[model samples]
Target: MGPEGGGDALLRLEGVSKRYRRSGLLALDDVSIWVGAGERVGLMGPSGSGKSTLACIAAGLLSPNAGHVRFDGVERSGGGRLPRGRSAAVRRAWLGMQMVFQDPEASFIPTMRLGDAVFEGARYLPRFKGADKDRLVREALEAVELPGSYAERFPYELSGGECQRAAIARAVIGRPKLLLCDEATSALDVTVQAKVMALLGRVHRELGTAFLFIGHNPALVGGFCDRIYRIGGGRITEELEACERP
Candidate 1:
């Protein structure tokens, strides 16, 4: 079994269940999982196995028909609560939660400059404006090791790896306490995938962000995650603890 949830867990999904109205699909069934502060948790299963649905609910985008979500010890149902509340607008307020998608191209706005897009999330942070904002934008770009000049370039002007890195940069800029990644490296080639993994490693080890990583590769999960949960048919079927690290 995985470690139990309590006051220390940064995020928790308890007895969570969801059904897609349009498809009449039971996306999740009595699933319970938790991520502790600064911990790395891996969720893995094959495609069409409700991994993305779980991610959506965790991010507070989709409401579950049953069960509850808790962030920072507060339980949320129908939707998640932010620092102050859980209205639709509050959901968008981004209270310590962020997501990184697999397809970076689809996530970015075509017309927006890369720099503008990367720092957009930090606008939600308090005391964020002027020099600090600009500095954050640059720092976020640098976090992914993208060149300063690349910030001014459009997403179309960059390679896939660069764009994906920018997407990660955007996700990390706000310094969200928890990052829910839905196959964040699937679109990149092997080399770029390694780079993204390394970036995520630093984000996990250095920034103290609890990560709920959704992916298919077991090896990758073992390297970065403290615990690995195998989710199947909308429920967690197994939990694998990481091997002792050097």
Candidate 2:
């Protein structure tokens, strides 16, 4: 996907602004940035600093009061109004964008089987049915280094790290071009977090997936991302090259 204004960016935000309440407390103030294809950019900011708000806008979940968001040159509305009848079509065709949130436990269905949970979205694609869906489910599970038998287990049965991996497998099963990771590894133990980060890096390299890695930890971003953007006071305060970090 190309950037806005005819460039190489996979995602671009231009003069985007958002405010809450009548007093006009800005969550985002005319923020502008571009993420190139296969580029991993980390977003760092303290709590309540609007990093998540910006991420929500980028993911097409929240609409901006002003400005434009372009994904692969296609304009996206900040409002969550997907076109009628075409919503499914757009989602299926643009399987390149996926989001893995910070809290995997909140995202998964506690009652559903692990396999079903991972392949839940796949049911929307008609081409993947019965055996095809089963195969894809197995592949996704394996990709996350989970055993095939895990398919029968429920969310409560797996450890926190395993559950998170399952969530990631679900997101990647469709082979998205852009992966928005909003503090995805924040909840895991150090060892588990390292494993997940390594898996994500490998996926990015192997599939050429562009990653928008959002987090507060400089060390975590330094280990995985090529560039880092520190957001504060409703705007990006610093843009650093990871290679230059000391």
Candidate 3:
């Protein structure tokens, strides 16, 4: 399976490839995928099959050896080079994207309070500045079922599930158009994972945010995604529609 009709997609990756220099391993090979606006797409693969690598590349956190990443109809970057000056400025203003990692604790600053970490990104935006920032943060936390008071506590103080919820609050505070979930629920317990999945569903419905859910669990991916891509051996081997799952 390769990139399908994505002219109107919110995120598009074309012929992407990534190779690690130290290990000389090809983590991804000619991978192509797309997530349309408010669409839920899943990437499923076993460990070390390049699922996380693909997620990082999509999030613009890792540079691919070859390929093009387009977001909102604009080319993001290629060949380890990032946009600069005018291009970078325009991108910053329209930065309607966010990513949540598997380990929520790792996403936070160990020394920072939970509230400050959640407000970090929002504070940079014009609408979330000053008093509005606090309100926005509280609203985000509330949406994630986290108490506003929990914001005062540090990341180490919350349980794993609670921390994950906080991480979600941080990601959604900006009302991103694209949300990347890189094994976001893998670290939680089975019961907690279900709760988190439900929460993500609610968030998607309320915000209409497109999602690229990367994980290894077929059951989880099948349950949450509208379409699923099976990535293995560093490439997408199959694609499945909702009715075709399992």
Candidate 4:
């Protein structure tokens, strides 16, 4: 990746804003952020600072009231309704812009086997089938250090840390260009969090996947990301190239 706005950016958010209808709260305010191809960027903020809200807009999960989201050099905006085909294209981009939430259990399909759940989203990709699909699932699980036999198990059979690892596996299975981690390791015990953090680093290094880590922890972000942005009041307040790590 080159300088901030130089070419080769994988994702970029330009002057985005969002507000909630219920309470009329402004969640994001003219926020601009970018992640270059294979770059690991970190976002840190206090609770309710809207880092997660910005992540949603960046991933196309929620549309912003203003500004645009650009991915793979294609500019997309959540500021307004899009044409049906454009919406579908956004959804397709989302498949490659996977996210892992704080609670893995909340995202699981209780009835589906772990392997099947991991492979669920990839079937839509053209000609991705049979042995290739199966291999992808197994490889993804292995990437997160989950045992091969875990694939046959169900979500209830795994511990919290194990489930989170499975969640990482599921996200990477699609070979996403961007990975959004919203407090992904915050729920785990210290030891388990360390393991998950290590797994994330390994994934970033091995896959060359750009990661946008959203959390309140400065040390975690400092240790993992190449660039760090601090957010408050729905806007990026500071850019810190150095922070105390680990």
Candidate 5:
């Protein structure tokens, strides 16, 4: 099933469930959610409430134990895997979506220059085929409010906030249709969080990309999303609209 209230969604999770085999812990239970094209959706919960688990599943980084994940009308069921010959399907799944993690510094390779790190994924994108690496890296950095000079620096050289902005630059450079941000701003101070949020807002507006903004902070999520869903104990406890956010 698609999202309630109209237009075809870019991503949909229907009755999805996940459980860790090692600890025998249920991280998600019958979770259903959707994000429409260019829509901003928020998933909010406390720590250990299955927030990151759901994000990982939605992004196809992890498989759900049950239920279906639909992206752009294609469906991937529980425990499903893309077959070896399905190159197009694989490309659709990967190139159209991107994820940003909580720790920006850890997201990159310490040995690589920031410019190469940011352009690595994007270079394979069809739109950037034959595109100049330096130009793409500079433009991506500029979009994230970073100077082009910073691209020569390594991940260790940047502050947390700066590194996060670079991560955002890397994620957006590919022009992904959906961006899954898992605790993207939690590591930053209040002021830096605001700035990062503002940068995200600009990215969304300019690129018209849909977002699944996952975090523990209700205030931050509510401020950025059009709709909010609250999860607790591995289940969705509440759904809040932008106007109804608390």
Candidate 6:
């Protein structure tokens, strides 16, 4: 089923469930959620509440034990079976979605230059070579409020905030229709975090991208999301309109 409020939904998770075998613990049980095109939703929970697991399943990185994930009304990859030889097609569809991790430092290769790192996944585009790639790299950096000169510097040379912005630059350059941010701003200080959140708001408004923002901060998520879902005890305990939250 699609989201109830009536716009064309970009992603839907129906009766989704997942469990880990080692301890036979259920991480998510009969979870259902949908994200409308250009909508921003936030997921909040205490640690070990399956927040990241939900993100992994939503991003097609992990298959759910049961149920379905749909993107644009068609079933997505990872959480369900695909038609023969259509796995690549599913992956291609996912190319328009990106995930930003809690720790940006862990997502990048220490050996790769920041520019190459940002443009790595986009190499498939025929026009993405030479000067064009350079131009994009510069534009992406600037989009994240980073100076152009920072592109040549490696990840280690950047501060924590800069590294996180670089990770965001990588996701935005792909021009993703959906961005799954898993604690993307958690590592930064309050001021820098605000800046990153503002950047995200600008990107979403400009590109019409839907954001599934995952974080533990109620105040932060309250300010940026259209709705908030609280996960606890392996289930969504509450759903609140962003403006109505106390």
Enumerate clash totals for all models, in the order shown. Answer: 0, 4, 0, 0, 0, 0
Give stretches of model 6 more than 4 Å off.
1-7, 77-84, 87-90, 125-131, 244-246
Deviation in Å, model 3, residue 6 alpha carbon:
1.0
For model 1, how does the per-residue alpha-carbon lDDT over 1-246 read when each residue is reduced to its tens digit? 224643457788888999989899998999988888888888999997889999998888888888888876556556543445545444543567889999987899999998889887777665464546667788889888998777789989989888888998998887888899899888888999998888898887778888899999888877778888899898899977877331
lDDT of 2 by residue, 1-246 (tens): 223432768888888888986777899998887788888888889988888888888888888999888776466643744445555556565456788999887888888988888887566665665557677888899988998789889988988899889998989887778899999999899999999998998888789998899998889987788788889988988887786322
Tens digit of per-residue lDDT, candidate 4, span 76-129? 644533445665556566567889999898889888899898887577665465
Candidate 3 lDDT over 1-246, as tens digits, reads 224577777888899999999999999999998988888999998899999999888878889999898887777656534566646455753468799999999899999998889987566666654566667778888989999888789999999999999999998888888889999999999999999999999888889988999998877888888898899989999977755322
Residue 175 C-alpha lDDT in model 5: 89
| Local distance difference test values of all predictions, in order | 0.82, 0.82, 0.85, 0.83, 0.86, 0.84
Q: After superposing candidate 4 on the true structure, give the runs of residues whose Cα lies further than 4 Å from its correct spot.
A: 77-82, 86-94, 243-246
lDDT of 5 at 168: 94
lDDT of 5 by residue, 1-246 (tens): 225653478888888999899999999999988888888999999999999999888877789999888777677644555545666756566567889999999999999999999997597777777888898899899989899998899999999999999999999998899999999999999999989998999888889988999998767888888888899999999987866322
Q: Residue 73 CA error for candidate 3 (Å)?
A: 1.3
lDDT of 6 by residue, 1-246 (tens): 126753467877777899988889899999877788888989999988989988888887888998788876567655444545675556567677788999998899998899989997576544455547888899999999999788898999999999999999999897888999999998889999988898898988899889899999989999999888899977989988887322
Structural similarity to truth (TM-score) of each candidate: 0.90, 0.89, 0.93, 0.91, 0.93, 0.90
Native-structure RMSD, model 6: 2.8
* Pairs of residues at least 3 apart in sequence or in different chains that clash in candidate 4: none
Which wins on TM-score, candidate 2 or candidate 4?
4
Task: State in Å the error of residue 44, model 1.
Answer: 0.5
Cα error of candidate 5 at position 80, Å: 6.1
